[model samples]
Target: MTDVPGFPPHTQLLAALARLGQATRMDAVRNAGPHNLSPLQADIVGLFRRGAAVLRQSDIVTALASTAPTISDAVRVLRRKGLVDATADLADARARLLVLTPAGEAEAERLTAFSDGLVEAVDTLPEQDLAAILRAGTRLMRELESRNLIPMSRMCPTCRFFVPDAHPGEVRSYHCDFVDAPFGAAELRVTCPDHEVRD
Candidate 1:
């Protein structure tokens, strides 16, 4: 095995752990359902699924650190598939809100099940190893989150803080309730408080 600098002899072990986690998530998405969601789609669904009670398209964009057009396309596709729904914002007459449909919720549950299985499998490992893995994974997540590398866009429609446009043709800023502010069109590089980077 090739040696990585600064990492100990267990580097391969670490790599294997990371790869297994990723593979498990991919497998979950693959086995989830007929949704046939792209990685982006899956991410978006995941966002909405987790935030079924309240979500919005702009929330998804901010979380994903993506452009409005990118999120709009994903939202359109999800809507076409009948996985998500958009409604007028009660407080803001100009904004619409996004949420998952029953079918979408079911699909999201399936994906969550897949993820749960992976966690259970990991739990079956030796206690020491499992503990180490947990600690390492937590550390890794913190480091990545600090770098804004986690996939935030996937949760677009599911984010509790998302606020969509009420009128289809009307252009409006994406409001993130979590951040208590709307994203400015020119502030693409600025990270919001709810930002979650997705790979």
Candidate 2:
């Protein structure tokens, strides 16, 4: 697409905003090491960080606009990794309540700091441009969420498109040697080329 100057109208502006937001998120994952979280896990952690008290699997699925299975799988991984703790919901034995562990809390803090730095950097942009970007980004994100096209489970670390430690808070966007194509929620499988199935 040709780059038209001055916020290429609404649709183009939203698409560009989505791309930028994705890029920023990928960058944050590259910088925060030790544990590599999938986008869904990161979102879950972020929600918890933002005071999502008493979350259920369904809640996460709704928030991330992902399929139930995808959210369940991500939650399982997070639980296995000791990043999240789950308990049977008092009212519904079949439903589990999820919460961040102490370790998860620490990691969330780091992630939040990284995100803050990212936003602060963006804040340096001219006021009008920054406002436009924010508006576009928010609109695009909401639209994607509604469409269930936002791959909550996809993460830079596990995707074939990811380049390990490419740079702090930054990873190549789904262009790594592992997966030839970018990953999405539908591609979540145990035999993915980019990542090994955790036992």
Candidate 3:
């Protein structure tokens, strides 16, 4: 609890994120239920809407930290509901790529509205607060990645194009070689479409 003495900031931040994540999931489920979706189904659809243009069943499992059976069940339900369809993976015939159907696109749009309140709340924060959280959150994600506790993110710092300021004589800049632009600590992309993971 916040009242606890000597509580680590990292622990407190993670706890807060956990609580917020649960609350957001609850809101998503309540709003999506009218459209005949369970919480997991809604989330799977969301991943399809935002994470990638096409995803494998295994990709969902990895992103959600979920089991194969769990993802499989949700995918089945989504397919049956005409929200998604599966096609043979051209790269691997044994695998299937999951794609949202037209109905699924509609559902994604509706879900976006359902979660608009959460977005608005975050957007209402002071600019400094927003910048602080984004920096801290990205650092925490990097730490988690180092410990193998989570999947590697597409954060700017991990990209091949990232050039962190090091020398005192330097301009103290964060540059992206790929874009030929300065990337400030607060303006870094959390999930970028063009992200190429560093080795």
Candidate 4:
């Protein structure tokens, strides 16, 4: 579907991904708008899903691929809303760690399932398509991280436990030392709590 004449094949794929991202953003708006929170604000809350993440304003800027001023402004708004609090980082006196309040944690948990509709839509695709998309997405993420265009993601390719193509002839080729199990491309995780940096 390379509708853009004279363009490379990747252009079409990138365009398709952008469309999907737009759809997801609209869904985020529908869920966060009523609560007086923007999509980005909701995402900020969601970042604490693993636990009380010891994150600073700069860390959030990197994580979201946003500018420091933008994140700082957003943090100020969040603090005013009582959804988040910035406290002194025990390890670094000069840095302030962003923490979600009880209400903020509740909001974060709620936001986790905001993409349920998107997930259901994806589930409609055939297994082959799903696997292909997962592989492409993982590769794209890796490239972006390598270029520092995006922060390192908790995907299989960047994990200490990942062993790619460990079982070439098997249905599940990749190996994960963390669980001592083999998984296919479709099982690749984009944000895993158990992820450990490869280097």
TM-score of each: 0.58, 0.59, 0.79, 0.88
Q: Candidate 2, which ten residues in sequence have the lowest lDDT sum?
A: 184-193
Ranking by lDDT: 4, 3, 1, 2
Give the lDDT of residue 173 in candidate 2: 23
Model 1 lDDT tens row, 121-159: 866877556545544554565566568877432232334
Relative to the unseen true structure, what is the C-alpha lDDT of residue 66 in candidate 2, on a scale of 0 to 100? Answer: 76
Off by over 4 Å in 1: 1-18, 115-124, 151-199
TM-score quality measure for candidate 4 = 0.88
Q: What is the lDDT of residue 124 in candidate 1?
A: 82
Q: Is candidate 1 or candidate 3 better by TM-score?
A: 3
Runs off by more than 4 Å, candidate 4: 1-6, 50-52
Return the lDDT, model 1, position 77.
91
Task: Report model 2's TM-score to 2 decimal places.
Answer: 0.59
Candidate 1 weakest lDDT stretch, 10 residues: 184-193
- RMSD of candidate 4 to the truth, in angstroms, is 2.8
Model 1 residue 177 lDDT? 64
RMSD of each: 14.1, 17.4, 3.9, 2.8
Can you give the lDDT of residue 182 in candidate 2? Answer: 39
**How do the candidates rank by TM-score, highest first?**
4, 3, 2, 1
Tens digits of per-residue lDDT for model 2, 1-199: 9776765477776687679778777876676446778766787787776545569998887756778998888889888888899988989989999888998888778766555667687768875575455444444544664576764333333344454344444322223445454332222232232343122
**Worst 10-residue lDDT window, candidate 3:** 164-173
Clashes of 1: 20
Clashing pairs in 2: 27-169, 27-170, 30-169, 31-169, 160-179, 161-174, 161-175, 161-176
lDDT of 3 by residue, 1-199 (tens): 5576876887887788999888887887668655678888987887766568799999999887789999999999899999999999999988999999999988876775656677788889887687678788888889988898887777877888777673334433577878877656667677676677777
Q: Candidate 2's error at 152, in angstroms?
A: 15
